[model samples]
Target: MITQNSINQLTYEIIGAAIEVHKILGKGLLESVYHKCMIEELKIRKINFKSEFKVPINYKGVDLDFDFKCDLFIEDLVIVELKAVNEILPIHDAQLLTYMKLLSVPKGLILNFHSNNIFREGQKTLVNEHFKNIPK
Candidate 1:
């Protein structure tokens, strides 16, 4: 079973991987660069994740053909969205939340690779009702 504590630990590791990538690459790079580096980092850490994971859409009990992709789906527990923008907008948060809802995951994170300090200004974590319902 996935408890709140387990999710928290997994989130911590994911953030650490992002920070490591940012530390080596420094920022202002393309989102693809960060995406690739994150993939390597996760592999080095033995973390399981799917890159460019397609989130299936179902409407009215019918599966849609639209392709909604998440940057990273970690351990089937978190949805991580990567960005290389000047700032994190509401749409970015919305995107992550939407992915979380679609995947029924408890946690989501937005990692912007354009800031000087990734842990401080470059990262945003969000959780939904699924998270609240989990055991701590």
Candidate 2:
């Protein structure tokens, strides 16, 4: 039953969890701190997620051994990338997009924990061709 509407709702819940973590920890913390808090928040909310999930690479019908890890892979649907930088750079977007492409995921999120507000300035959601093919 994965649809655009469902994905949107799931995204809302994920962002809410991040907001809760930011509200308590505030800014100026390390990315790992926020990462750990997010894990707890997701568990408390009963959201399914995998932390430090590995992204496999394949080339010419051969699987390559690599250690590309995504910060959070939620419900096998969304790829969540956590950051605690002063600002999100293009490279951050590229990184998340690349993960989404490699995994063939429909949606991805960049959650920056260093912003003033998680809901307002801290989150960026991106979608790719996979998303376009999903039912509405």
The clash count of every prediction, one per candidate, is: 0, 0
**Model 2, span 15-105: residue lDDT tens:** 9999999999999999999999999999999999999999999999999998889999999999999999999999999999999999999
- The Cα error of candidate 2 at residue 100, in Å, is 0.3
Q: RMSD of model 2, in Å?
A: 0.6
The TM-scores, one per candidate, come to 0.98, 0.98
lDDT for 124 in candidate 2 is 98
Clashing pairs in 1: none
Stretches of candidate 1 off by over 4 Å are none
Cα lDDT listed for each candidate = 0.95, 0.97
Error of 1 at 69 (Å): 0.2
What would the per-residue lDDT of candidate 1 be over residues 29-135, giving only the tens digit for each residue? 89999999999999999999999999999999999997889999999999999999999999999999999998899999999999999999999999999999999
